[model samples]
Every structure is written in structure tokens, then in C-alpha cells.
Target: MTAPSEAARYSIQMLISDWLLIDGTMDNHVWSAVEQPGGDGAADPDIARRPEVARLGLSVRRAGWDQIAGWPHDLEGFTTWPAPGQTARMSLSGAQWSLVVLALRYWADVDERMSDVDGAARSRGIATSVEQRLVSLGWSPATP
Candidate 1:
């Protein structure tokens, strides 16, 4: 695949940053608020009402692969889906390398937040949400 353009790299970085901030805030605060209220049924409406949570949810839904074009087909075997695990052995332009690194970072951040919420059954929704976002970006756990 062709290397991502400079503008594409910047856009992916911005998206990764936004996703991390929103997801981190949710992990630190909103999930706790939801669990405090008996940890059952749907997520607390009040938690969803928080501006940051609302924005984060919206951003996840809106995320797409438009800026990514296509990921490197020559990636070292998938470590755990979207993340490439290690840098590609083949030559890649700087833009392509940045894209891969940023994507892996994003995956790690989301996975960490998923683990944080794994203890609560109701909180599994957060993992589902992350999975949906990854799917929207054309990633699947089934990817080889």
C-alpha cells in the first residue's frame, strides 16, 4: 500500500489523542459513577449526560478509515487484531510508520481501559463499545 500522506498522519494522530483522552476519562470517572448505582441494567443516564462521555461516545461512533487508506498488507503476523505488535520489517515511509505506531498505541489504550472495567458485568459494555469502534475502522478480532 502507498504510504499515508502527511495530512493523513496528522489526522490519525489527532484521532488517537481524542480517543485516548475520552476513553481514559470514562475509565477513571464515568464507569465508576455507573457502577455506583447498583451496577445493573443500562448505564446510568447521568453518566452518559456528562459532556466528556457524550463526546467520547460520539467520536467512537464517527471514527472511520477514510484517512488510513489501507494498512500494510505485509504486517508481521497480527498480535491481537488491529495492533501490529512490532514494526514492519519491510521498508515503509515515515508517514506509514507513524500511522502504524499511532494505531498500536490507540489499541493499547483502549485495551487497557477494557481490562480496567472487566470486573463489572455491566461495564462490559465499554469493551463492546471499543470493539464497535475498532470494527468501524475496519479492524476485527478475527483478522489474521
Candidate 2:
């Protein structure tokens, strides 16, 4: 298959780990999209997944590949929305390597936040709010 142009190759995956919202607030955690092990390991999959897709969030939505195409590509590189932020790290796998560092920054940021929230459970109030935010954001955990 032909490689997407430098333009087509550029993309971002919005990880919701930091924004996961376990009780009712941002989960304040970090995450990464590892290929289901055997699936990608170090190789790209037969079909590439969206970089901006979010899962297990109260407000973020699971973006389809088609939607990823429409995201802002003109930016200097990967950036978080509601911006004025820090850089996240990107762990590019086979096909994902097409995108550069700037595009991968947000993922790193999300992962960092998750690390902050790592601990015992909190009150349900925050949890409920997170759920509402997840729905508002368009994210529905795969099981729910």
C-alpha cells in the first residue's frame, strides 16, 4: 500500500487515561495502546487504528478511523485540546511510526496523569461526575 503523504502520515491518538474518571473526576492516570501483543508486537497491523481514539472515559469518545482523517493536521505536531499544555510522549508501533514526536506528545501526558491518580478508590461523587463527563465526551467503555 502507498504511504499516506507526510500530510496523511501525520496523526494523533487522544488517550483518555488521565481523563479516565474512575469515581467522578479525571482518573489522573497514564496509558498506552499496545497491540494486543501477538497482534502488532513490533509490526503494524493489517489495518491501522486511529491515533486519537479514546476509551474508558466519561467524556471522550471512541473515534473511528474515518474521523481521525478529519482532525487538524496543520498543527506543528501533536497537541492536546483545551490547550496551553505540556508535551506527551508517543510510543509508535509499526505503522504508527509514520507520525512524528509532536503528534505523540499528548499520549505521554495522559499516561503521566494516570500515574498521579494511581491509588485506592475515592468517593462516588467524583466517580459519578466522571461517568457523566465520559458520556458527554462520547466515550462508552467497551463493556458499558
Candidate 3:
């Protein structure tokens, strides 16, 4: 794959550092949304849930970027944590930012969809099961 452009890298870095703030504890709602299976509404409902999960899944499936970085990689794509005494620092590339954006967007969409589904279910007096709720939001179950 081609490397991302410098402008794209900077834009993505700002998004992570300033907006998403991945270096810190992610917001509970954001985390919840990201960790759910409806984020991307993709065929692999399981993988579409969270960005980190998707990234790991992709890495393994594609056999690329396997050892490059871990979950919540720093701005510079390093796998190191952001505590004191760690000198490793690098900016996130455009591709990395794209993944992050995809996760965030997916989470946002799922969160909204869940809210709507819950509201509708409540109105209908239906105690929706998790699987049912996911299906209501357009997620298909894992195939045998």
C-alpha cells in the first residue's frame, strides 16, 4: 500500500490527539460504541464493532503491520504508551488516521442506531435480546 501524504498524516494526528484523544482514557460512550458489532454494519458484523479489533483482525488476516503497533498506538504509530520517560514518538500516518476515523464513525452510527432501536423497542414493550437488537440495527449473525 502507498504511504499517506504529509497533510493527511498531520490531519489525522490532530484528530487523534485533539479530537478523539486516544492517548487518554476514551470516553465511555465512545468506547461502548466502538466496541459494539454494528459500527461498520459490514458483512463481518463481529469485526465491524470496534476499531482496534478491526485493526487487529485486518493485520492478522492480511499478515501486514503485525508487529508494528498495538491498540491505541501513539500519534507517531509507535506501540509505546504515553507515560513519562518514554521517548519514542512519531506522527500517525494517513492510513492509520483513516482506520481511526472509520472506527469512530462506525461507533457513532451504531450508537445512534442503538438509541433509536431501544426507543422503538421500549415503545413496543419489547424486551429485545442482544442479538435481536443487533439485527434490528442491520447486523447479521456470524455464519456457521
Best by TM-score: 3
Candidate 2 vs candidate 3: the lDDT winner is 3
User: Which segments of candidate 2 are over 4 A away from where they belong?
Assistant: 1-71, 75-129, 132-144
Per model, state how many residue pairs clash: 0, 29, 4
Model 3 regions lying over 4 Å from their true place: 1-8, 11-42, 45-90, 116-144
Error of 1 at 73 (Å): 12
lDDT of 2 by residue, 6-32 (tens): 212212333323222221221221123
Candidates arranged by lDDT, highest first: 1, 3, 2
The candidate scoring highest on lDDT is 1
For model 1, which pairs clash? none
Candidate 3 residues 1-144, lDDT tens each? 343333332211121122322222124334443554464546454554467554433432232223223435355644443333322223344344334334444444454577865433332222123224334434333311
List the candidate 1 regions with Cα displacement exceeding 4 Å: 1-88, 116-144
Q: How well does candidate 2 score on lDDT at residue 127?
A: 38
Compared with the true structure, all predictions reach lDDT values of 0.38, 0.30, 0.35
**Looking at candidate 1, what is the lDDT of residue 71?**
37
lDDT of 2 at 57: 24
TM-score of 3: 0.30
